[model samples]
Target: MALSHSLIQLLISLRRQKFIGAGEPIRMLEFGEQNWFYDVVPAELLILIDEFQDVPAERRQALKAELQQILDTKPPTEPFDICKVFYKLVFNYEDYTAVDLHGTPQALSLDLNEPLGLPPHSWDVVTNIGTTEHVFNQYQAFKSLHELTKPGGVIMHSLPNQGCFDHGFFNYHPTFFYDLAEANRYEIVALVYADCSKHPHQLKQLGSQADYVRLAVSHQLSAYSGIFCVYRTPTDAQAFKVPRQGYYDNRLPPELQQAWQNLAR
Candidate 1:
């Protein structure tokens, strides 16, 4: 069995125990990590895994072989949707059929790399939570989102503030907010900080004044930058512009977007 499968099983078990809250769930499959959004919210969640380039050559080869074996052997379940092309896949596209009757139709899981290629107006909303900072090509990613969204489509994003510990290969970049909005021509709607101190348990784990100061400084310098953004596409008909800094502009609209731009500036 591949280590990724073991990890998924472990996560599923933990989820059943209520250990993992409602968050983005990803499964490492034969191709790449598949996002299981149908089990959660449909179109609202986009699955993005970090550190693809850093995998050691040998391990990557082993992973590909393991994935192929799993794919050839495992039968598709009723709820699963498999994509053999991209390294990432989607499971359970049809899970929402029953949900539409509940009056809470869930959104579908979208792959950032391989878009659905639907018209811009097809989707009502697009969100990127804690994802932009990891991209090596942030500008291109945001531009792609701009083109994908309809005019007035809402976008929400959560990016790390400067002082936080490095969770991925790339650390937080302060200019992400400005660049995203400017490039995509998105209007900023709302910007809110995800205060780390609110979670005292996490604070305790990161004990010590210096450590706390580092966290505070990083966030303060960059606006306590956790989960900042509530953006909306412009009403204007211009093509979506990619920002120079990060991938997408997280800003909302004129009234709200202006406020965040002013504050961040």
Candidate 2:
């Protein structure tokens, strides 16, 4: 998975809202060794970075230099490591780990089908960016995120919601997250749908978990979209909560089901 401009904005917004790095360094575990997809940083991102108030002046200057180097070198897109460079420079993380099936020879080979078996509840932020859809065993793919995150920490997922044919083993629906968060008792931080057919920043927020079905029927949204779900794990540690589909168990209202049925006709 690659880091797009929108993902950068989301991370920065989380920090601004004091969800992360309120007064401490971040410990982030990403599902993949993400890279910045663009050679030059987008202006929107630079503006946000300049406005960020948490970083000390010297650290900010260092960040400026790091970004300048990216522009100066115009590094090749492959193996640029821009995502790692930016996150490390900007957050100055306490720890950062990337688990992937492929990486440097020294990097551990990971299969998403099994638990990471890392120290339980060790990470402050865990991300599944564009990874789980490729895994056939979806349960294990998501359970690993639950196991790795510290209680009260955050878990973020960005996956294809609509119109990515044959790109992976499966695509996601917003209701999947609604049920997952409902079952796990995760605090809903943000739920957004992005029009990813073009630039990555075109996002539309889903007001609440209920809005997943509500908006789908009301707006008739059928685009090449990506679902971005950010949840704060419950403060009390617990086992992974298995979820049932919302409509099947009356978790979603009958009106929403009727509306969806009408839309299908």
Candidate 3:
């Protein structure tokens, strides 16, 4: 069952406590200040940034110039924890080892296509914000995330909704809500929408008053509208399920059972 916003917040609070006591500081990669990082501290922290050619040509060039300037200047405080950041030019299977950046050793920059080989139940929290939609195989990604997290671990994710403009890259997909739940075998804890028009480009696209209204209404009705779901990993028995079988049996109160029979028929 999907979780209410209040229940989701409560779980986040509880997770924060356990995460604090885990003896290591919170470790976040590929996520930034927009996340819940301020709430927890880890003994060691690492961040990874992956670059891709899918970005707009102009923006890509501008970012490259910006990065070169930043690299030359060596700013006083690193934008993220730990020293190095990675730029993977191509997807390769054997590049999963740590890399040396700014004199620090951190895990090799991860490509969504590659596996980390992390044991099941290793992470306390995993967050993927606006990243999964870019992946070609979202189901495999979710399965990998499920395996990477410790039991009772949580995944915080945000997906784009309808009415979002195509940015020339494969930025959108349909039916992720149902797919993610089944893929990770997780119960959704919360679902919320994020107004992407808050970004200038999106807002500009809705130039006229009528256009803005249409966009707004479409966003409101979309099932994909930026969702935030928190799930507790099920126990082995609960997690295990056979293919082509109903997880819930038909035996129940007469009224409930009758409803189930009607649906089955």
Candidate 4:
């Protein structure tokens, strides 16, 4: 799994809109040491560089030089570490850590299939971008993501939603997140369905499961569609709460059920 340009754009947009990482620096924890699909740095990242308004002018210039060095030194065939190179550089935030079983330069050796055994509520931001689906123990992986996030912090995920056939252990559906958030009392920050077939991705923001179904019917969406989500962990978030399937549990709100019914008409 790799970090794509659209993910970076999502992060930049969140900062600009003050969704998170605004007043002060943030401590970010990533599931894996992820690389970019792009051979070279995308030009649009200059906008992300500009948003580092909290940093001093000198430090900001230094960050730019560091980015330039990466471009000059790194071969295009070997993509740069998105977490270390892009996220850290753009935010100028040093409190970033990545955990991977392989222990790459940007990651600490840790297994996601078991308990993380790390300090709880230590990270202001926890990300599982295209990582957890590959973990056979989905429960443990998700629990780790939940446990790592600090109170009032956010946990971001990008998982297969519609049709990533044989891409990973499983493909997710919108109800999975909807019910997960409901069970954990996580505040749903944003939910988006993305068509990742090409660059400059197409996205549809979703508020409910019906929205996902509607988006599927409304367009010639690709089989590689993805669910992009950000959910805020409340200060009082308890232990990781497993949820029953929303459909069988009759958990969907009445309005949403009506919406789904309307779609069938």
For each candidate in turn, the TM-score is 0.41, 0.87, 0.45, 0.87
Residue pairs clashing, model 3? 24-43, 25-41, 25-42, 25-43, 26-41, 26-42, 97-108, 98-107, 98-108
**For residue 78, what is the lDDT in candidate 2?**
35
What overall lDDT goes with each candidate model? Answer: 0.40, 0.76, 0.39, 0.76
lDDT by residue (148-220, candidate 3, tens digit) is 6666655656545555456222443222443445544765654444343442112122222233234444544
For candidate 1, lDDT tens digit of each residue in 227-265?
345567777646755455422344344543443344433
For model 1, how many clashes?
A: 25
Give residue 5's error in model 3 in angstroms: 18
Worst 10 residues of 2 by lDDT: 39-48
**Candidate 3: worst 10 consecutive residues by lDDT?**
86-95
RMSD of each: 15.3, 2.7, 14.4, 3.0
What stretches of model 3 exceed 4 Å from their correct place? 1-77, 81-107, 168-175, 182-185, 198-225, 237-265
Question: Where does model 4 exceed 4 Å of error?
Answer: 43-47, 51-54, 75-78, 81-83, 89-92, 217-221, 254-265
Clashing pairs in 2: none
